[model samples]
Target chain A: EPEVTQTPSHQVTQMGQEVILRCVPISNHLYFYWYRQILGQKVEFLVSFYNNEISEKSEIFDDQFSVERPDGSNFTLKIRSTKLEDSAMYFCASSEEVGRNQPQHFGDGTRLSIL
Target chain B: GESVGLHLPTLSVQEGDNSIINCAYSNSASDYFIWYKQESGKGPQFIIDIRSNMDKRQGQRVTVLLNKTVKHLSLQIAATQPGDSAVYFCAENRLTGNQFYFGTGTSLTVIP
Candidate 1:
């Protein structure tokens, strides 16, 4: 089956450094999302993207974070300056269409570790 | 903000037995619910989903029951196997344009 794919299974960066996490959603998917899970915590929604723009974002998606569909198949999340608290497993998900009932398929996730 | 939470933190069952995981959502407006399974070191994998309009939906070896009136959901896994050991999470979506709120998750251990 087609699946969402993320790059760099693991990443380690300095607290003040920048990091870019990339994802390639299923080819036919129309809606994309970024979510994070701190160790032993719930999965938190960061942002949702549709039509090449941000459709919605949560409070956790602050100024330090940005998402882009830089190419036809690539969706990326950029953290300007990583913080220790930013360490978490970042997941990229996508759905074929927008509907409350539609299920979103997720990637394996990129484990971000900030020192 | 609305939150989705699991009633139990963990559950242990023997192989070939059945497992039931429960979840509660504070948002009455939540119109969609999904159950996901996550193995160690992996991401959440979609298992099954139920819409608010329906009370139940079933997949291969899993069944999902939703009680919108009580704002509760449950996932039932039949003939559980050792491979079924993982963390299961229930997520609720209040709107089509909104993001889903995930539950604390229940760790399921299927013993052999």
Candidate 2:
């Protein structure tokens, strides 16, 4: 089956540096999302995108965080001035359409480590 | 903020026994629920989902039961196998928003 794919399975960056996590959602998917899971913690929603605009975001998605669909297939999350707390597993998910019945499919995830 | 939680943190079942994982949500407005399984180094994989209008839904060897009144959800696996051992999570979505809130996961270990 077609699935979401993420690049740079593991990322290590300095505390003050900028990091961009990339994802290629299913080709036919119209809605994309970003979520993070701290070690041994529940998954937290960061943002959702549709029609090249943000549909919704959580408080955890602050000024330092931004998402972009630079092209037809790529969805990226950029975090500027990363901190130690920013280290976590970032996952990209997508669904063919938005509805009560459509379930989001997730990628394996990119492990982000801040030094 | 709304939250979803599991009833137990861990469960163990025999190789051929049936396993049931339970979850509870604090949001009364949640209209959709999903169950996901995650291995040690992987992201959550969708297993099954149910709408508030339905009390039960089944797929393959898995069954999902939803109780709208009590805000409860459960996933049942028939004849659990070693591959079925993983961390299970429950997620809920409210009609007013597109975001899904995930719950604490339950770790299931299958003793073969």
Following a full C-alpha superposition, what root-mean-square deviation does model 1 have from the true structure? 3.2
Q: How do the residues A1-115 of candidate 2 rate in per-residue lDDT, one tens digit apiece?
A: 9999998899999999999999999999999999999998999999999999999999999999999999999999999889999999999999998654579999999999999
Instruction: Return the TM-score for each candidate structure.
Output: 0.95, 0.96
Off by over 4 Å in 2: A99-101, B1-7
Top candidate by DockQ? 1
Instruction: Give the per-residue lDDT digits (tens) of candidate 1, residues B1-112.
Output: 1123465688889899988888988689889888999999898999998888899999999999898888889898999999999999999888645688899999999889
State residue A38's C-alpha deviation in candidate 1, in Å: 0.2
The per-prediction i-RMS, to one decimal, reads: 1.2, 1.2
Best by lDDT: 2
User: What's the lDDT for candidate 1?
Assistant: 0.91
User: Per-residue lDDT for A48-106 in model 1, tens only?
Assistant: 99998999999999999999998999999999999999999999999998755679899
User: What's the lDDT for residue A23 in model 1?
Assistant: 98
Q: Can you list the residue pairs that collide in candidate 1? A: none
lDDT of 2 by residue, B9-88 (tens): 88988899898888988799998889999998898999999989899999989999998889889899999999999999
Worst 10 residues of 1 chain B by lDDT: B1-10
- Cα lDDT for residue A98, candidate 2: 66
- Least lDDT summed over 10 consecutive residues: which range in candidate 2 chain B? B1-10
